[model samples]
Target: MDEVEVVVAHSQRATLRVGEVFLKVDVDPAHADVEVRAMAMVPVPTPAVLWCEPPVLAIAAVPGTALGVLGAPSPASPAAWAAAGAAIRRLHDAPLPPWPGRKLDDVAEELDRECAWLLANDVLPAEVVRRNREIAEAVLRPWTPAFIHGDLQITHVFVDDEDRVTGIIDWSEAAPGDAMFDLAILTLGHEEHLDDLLVGYGDADRDVIRAWWSLRSLTASHWLIEHGFDPDEPGCEFDVLRARMPDS
Candidate 1:
């Protein structure tokens, strides 16, 4: 067999690797205001350290699984979040530490700043950002702080024929904070998953989920404007993320 180096680009960054094991790196050109912060690993129970040195890095054991989407979502409809909530729940269950990552105030502040920046850039209006800031602050306030698989979208699931999650990757944004934020990410991205993972989460009011989902959407929309991309024609799912946020 022959090996060639290829560059794989995700929403926030690109990965360059070759051969059986490919190293995927996520780069967010603008760190000041980002939605998901480019995940190198998904939300799963897999135990591994998620870190990056200016540029993101992920050394995968799979032959070419490190490639873009790793052939996820098949030939079409790759938008559906293939990652399972149960897997994310397990990730949340992982015994972690309450260091800076777990600080509730920090999370809230970051969301507020992103929203503020987006509003300033004309990506989002003043009223929308203000409302979103309120919602974000509320969600992060008084939270017990559970492990959040930062970027919980369809491709993260990594499933099989039975629809069972085989593995979860993209943990770069993984942090200890409000679980609602992560839950919102899953629900908003995968409508079908909302019900699928209800059992895994044990049970929660639908209204509660809505608030978090809305907050997540509002916070994520900034990624486009921050990158100087046209928010109207983002040409990707983040636009849907922006649309799903709804008006205040």
Candidate 2:
């Protein structure tokens, strides 16, 4: 049973809670609750089957509004970003079931489908869509996969007072693939706050992190182009992604 009533719809797949538990929809509402929440809770929040229409998904989750107001307001700040990075690291360290492939070539079909689906649905651009396909092929060729929050960026984080990360919401893209892919999103998403985050993380080379960011930069741009997203959107993560690219 859901802990709260759906007070209001905050986004396409997100909703506001009137009580403690937060209800969210990931993919395939009929799938096992465990698979739905494998991306969030550290020890598994234990989602259960319910008779509520649309499956009132029960999971331990945080509010998207709270996170957006605090965490995203200053993703470039040191204190703000460090907390964000650490939260991400903790998430990356979490165990997940392995998927079929680690090599870019292996997941090429899936990646292509994602890009294609977005494009076909009028969420991506024609010319730029091709770029996303090419980028996926290139990046996955020699990829070392780990658990990745495949759709991370500014909109995913939630922070508390004093600018500490309170929660990292949005697990729709969660998958056991490349850890670097997640790092790349975190790095590019919080470039302004990179220093603050790394201070606690120390001066680790973290090449994979760098690679993930650079590659995602290119791929994300393709997404933007396909979707006709303004390149100059204020504080938009896509601009950061482009700025961080070495070749760009």
Work out the TM-score per prediction. 0.64, 0.58
| Whole-model Cα lDDT of every candidate shown, in order | 0.51, 0.51
| Candidate 2 residue-wise lDDT, 1-248, digit = tens | 54557643422344545466555553456332434555434532222323233545654555322323212454235666666666666666677644442456545555665556656765434555454344434345454445566656665676656766655555545666766565556556445555666664454335555545435544454455555555346545444434443455
Misplaced by over 4 Å in model 1 are 1-13, 17-20, 26-58, 61-83, 125-127, 228-248
Candidate 2 TM-score, C-alpha based: 0.58
Kindly report the root-mean-square deviation of model 1 from the true structure over all alpha carbons.
6.7
- What lDDT does model 2 reach? 0.51
The backbone clash count of each candidate, in order, is 11, 10
Question: Candidate 2: worst 10 consecutive residues by lDDT?
Answer: 43-52
Model 2 residue runs over 4 Å out of place are 1-27, 30-35, 39-77, 98-103, 106-138, 141-144, 202-211, 217-248
